[model samples]
Target: MPEPNKDEWEQIAKDYDEKWNYLHCIGALDSKHVQIRCPAGAGSLYYNYKGIYAIVLLALVAANYKFTLVDVGAYGKNSDGGTFERSEMGKRFESNKYAVPKDKELLPAMEIPYVIIADEAFPLKAYLMHPYSKAAITSDEEKVYNCRHSRARRTVENAFRILAGRWRIFLKPIETKPEIADLIVLASTCLHNMLRNTSTNISLFEGQIRMESEHIHGVANLEPIRRNFVREVAITRDKLKKYFVSDYGSASCPWQWHSIRKSRVAPRRVQYYLLNTRIRYNRPF
Candidate 1:
């Protein structure tokens, strides 16, 4: 995938803010496991916690559900964090190679770095935001923050859903060598983006999108591993957490309070219910 220039990055961040209500978010990051038949002599290298032989499809998706970048063929045994850290995109991010727009104000005087929203599996950094640990969440503000964060991050999840739904090959274990499977995945993602760009009537596939969204598929609820983060990074998260509940911040969503309360009672059920609600209303959460 080609890297987005500074102007394109700014546009992505703007789209994310308008649609997902997450300020300065340029993309959503996630990984999906593509199952494959165990290759010759590749014993446990591709074995994952799910008891399947697979490869990791690490992706960074834009607000429109188009893949901005992807890294395929990582060992499935590795966690998303490790896979991303080793990816070419990750290395570029580490070296600040991408022409990302500089930090800007979310509110009048409070500036925050442009960030990518990920789940708990990824580390929190100055330029990346992950949810607060479930055990560490002591305030409603944190809950609100996580709710919005999940909403924004769902773009990547939905992108993967569309990819798998459209390409039936991903529904079953790819019967091929690891090298061929990698090429298949890469080509599919490229085509997926192209189709998304060219397709005129998205409503033609609404049923498939809804069906895929309703199912609780391969998501693994692993406990978030602790890692040492810089004080500035921690403070960055806290600022955004507070902003989600602040009256002055445009990121606050009125429905989040009700959603968070329902989540406290039944997390999974509320998630499923809210997802349907969004699909039905055809609007953001």
Candidate 2:
């Protein structure tokens, strides 16, 4: 099957922006292990952390739970980030082969390149965003960024869960050759996209839906936009964080503050959340 073209990616980005309240987001990338019996002459090549023999199915899922791009047949032993780097999709992205559209604004005067969101397993780059590492997140800004990023990135996981739920075959180890398993995975994703396109009311897997906020959300939050000196000072590295804690954004996520206040257990992550909550609620303690 042919890969999605540039126009298709742009359309997907528009859809994602609408659904996730995040602008300039093209897709969400993730991977899953598809269990298979060990192949002959390959002892540990397929062994993964789950203590099973498998192949990795790396995918870029759109906001609507459709699989826009997929790469299969990587060794299960590889980390998700490594598997992604070795995949054809990754190579193309690195080379700019797809010619993804030029940088666009997530908020007025705040320009950012179209990007794909991934979990902490992937590296942060110009075109891809991964959450702040729990170890390095020092301030409320990073904490809010991590929470918002993870919230949007969750769609890819939901897409895979919905696919696996619909196709029971993936739940069990397939006793087939690696090559055949790859074809099956490809076909399954194709069918998934087909069904999503044809049906309007398909029930998604039961998952938590975060409350939608009015503020523009994205990784571009780190970049300060300068329209005038006044607006420039207002839009700093923590512009997104400021919105999340502002009157309009703060009222939309009271649950976050309540949860943060009740949990004092530390490892710094909790402290980060508490700081964010305190700042958002205008309560220092």
Candidate 3:
């Protein structure tokens, strides 16, 4: 896929700020496991924790539910964070090769870098953001930040959902060599973007959908960054967290407070309900 230029990146950031209320966010980053028949002589290399053989499809999705960048054919044995660290896209991000826009003022006094939002499975970076751990969250500010982060990050999840829904080939283990499976996934993602650009009714499939191997654990197992850089990234996140609750920030929705309160009172039920709501209506809590 072609890389989004600086102008395109600015447009994506604007769309994300308007639609998800997250500022300076260029895209949502995540991965999906594309199940495939065991490769010849591969042994457990393709086996995931779920005991299935597959390859990973690591994707960076735009605010409009279209893929912006994808790294396919990673062994399922690798975690999403690990796959990303080794990907060509990841290298470019680390080296500033993509020329992601310079830090700009989010408000009059608060400047922040353009970032791609991801889930906890990925490492925190200056150019990437993730939510605080649920157990570590204490303040209402953190709670609101997590809520908004999840909301914006859902774009990639929904992109995958729509892709699988429209292309049912992802419904089952693809019966082909890993190489061929990679080609199939690449082709499908390209076609998905093409169809989304031309189709007016693509939102019909945006409803709740599920896929296998959707969850992964061990965020601590991902590669570590320099201690100083980690501190810088944490400070960046704290700034954004503070901004989310400020008057200058986008106004918080009533449902966000309601959901956060429910989370403190009945965490399990709230989680269950949120999952169901996302599946049923494709709406964020």
Candidate 4:
């Protein structure tokens, strides 16, 4: 058998990015889980809140909603923020060698932000942009930034929603090893990107994107354990009204996520996972 080379993977990443171009924007970053086939020795730790071996896929979606950098994976037990910390992208940035695409003259390479926007599950490091906690800053500027940021960050969640609805691979829990699980995810992402290129193909975003003037990406489900520990989870119905309405979900978050619970719904019962976070937005974090 022949060994795969770096160029092959790089091509995959490029093609993936092209597949996710929603409206000329490239690369939406979000973490998602794929249920595994189950490992013999893997403990409950491998089971995510989604009740599967959910590996963290740190991918970049294009403007058209095609995935580009479906290049790296992290343990399912890790949060988006934690996954980012240990990802190859993190190492590249830390070494200050993160590279931008400069191969095409027509699509000339532009040095955009090294990082992308994420939800409350992610920490507010220099590389990532998350919303502000409601208590962190109550100023008007903060409010405006939050609004704009949420708009941009919406892409991640939107992407995820589209993915789940279309693929349904993630709708169920996985039971495979972390590495093989990563391949399953990669194949799905690659398929998503390939189909995104042709408008004739029906995808998850088929009706969803048309509804909004500006399409945004979607976020993946959070671990049940980290839910209550996230400040955003701590917000009451009233706070949510104020916060989400004020675009608090967009800009200025050091917020925590609320853990998911087993409602009468079967999906709810299956959701159970946790990870140590870099930034704890609330107590017991």
Q: For each candidate, give its TM-score against the true structure.
A: 0.85, 0.75, 0.84, 0.57
Task: Write out the backbone clash pairs for model 2.
Answer: none
Question: How well is each residue in 1-285 modelled by candidate 1, as lDDT tens digits?
Answer: 778999999999999877777878989999999999999899899999999999999999998899999999999999888998999988888888899999877667787888888987888878778988876778888777777787778789888888987898999999999999999999999999899889877654655654553342222333666788777778788888777788865334567777677655457888799899999999886
Residue 262 Cα positional deviation in candidate 2, in Å, after optimal superposition: 7.3
Model 1: residue 228 alpha-carbon error in angstroms: 3.3
Better of 1 and 4 by TM-score: 1
Query: What RMSD, rounded to one decimal, does every model reach?
Result: 6.7, 9.0, 7.2, 13.8
Model 3 residue pairs with clashes: 208-279
The predicted structure with the larger TM-score, 2 or 4, is: 2
**1 versus 3: better lDDT goes to:** 1
lDDT of candidate 3 at residue 146, scale 0 to 100: 83
The candidate that wins on lDDT is 1
lDDT for model 4 comes to 0.49
Candidate no. 3 TM-score: 0.84
Best by TM-score: 1
- What would you estimate as the lDDT of candidate 1? 0.83
* Residue 53 accuracy (lDDT) in model 3: 97
Ranking by TM-score: 1, 3, 2, 4
Q: Which stretches of candidate 1 lie over 4 Å from their true place?
A: 203-224, 250-252, 266-285
